[model samples]
Target: MYAVIKTGGKQYRVIAGQKLKIEQIAADIGQQITLNEVLAVGSGEGLVVGTPLVSGASVVAKVVSQGRHDKVRIFKMRRRKHYQKRQGHRQNYTEIQVETVNA
Candidate 1:
């Protein structure tokens, strides 16, 4: 089965054995975490969507790693003003593997 869950102010569609990187969470490597904010659960053509969150529905995941994404460079310049600015940023993320979707 697959599930739609919310975390870190984002929503993700996930399935068992799938690995994805999400906003950094306070979890250790190899730790199992249950995501209780399940929005929907589905298999084949049968789908159950919750009003806000599915009661008792959850997604189980194992933390694989924590890391940062590639740096994003930002540059701004004003023509005829001789003004320029440059900046870069990297976003932290946590990698997790979906283990199960319980509904």
Candidate 2:
């Protein structure tokens, strides 16, 4: 089965044994996290979607790692005024492996 869950202001579609990177959460490596804000759950036949969240449904995952993503460079320039600016940023993220989706 698969589930759509919300975390860190984002939604992710995950299945058991799948590994994915998501916005950083306050959890250490190897920690077990239960994501209770399940938006929808689906199997072979049909899908159950929530109005805001699915009651009593959750996706359990294990935190594998915490790290930052590759730096993103931003630049801005104005030809006539000779104004130029450049900046770089790396966003923090967490790697987690989906363990189960309980609906």
Clash pairs for candidate 1:
none
lDDT of 1 by residue, 1-103 (tens): 8999999999999999999999999989999999999999999999999999999999999999999999999999999999999999999999999999999
Candidate 1 ranges with C-alpha deviation above 4 Å: none
**In candidate 1, where is summed lDDT lowest over 10 consecutive residues?**
51-60
Give the per-residue lDDT of model 2 (tens digit) for 1-103.
Answer: 9999998899888999999999999998999999999999999888999998989999999999999999999999999998999999999999999999999
RMSD in Å for model 2: 0.7
Cα TM-score of candidate 2? 0.97
The lDDT for every candidate, in the order shown, is 0.97, 0.95
Stretches off by above 4 angstroms in model 2 are: none
Per-candidate TM-scores read 0.97, 0.97
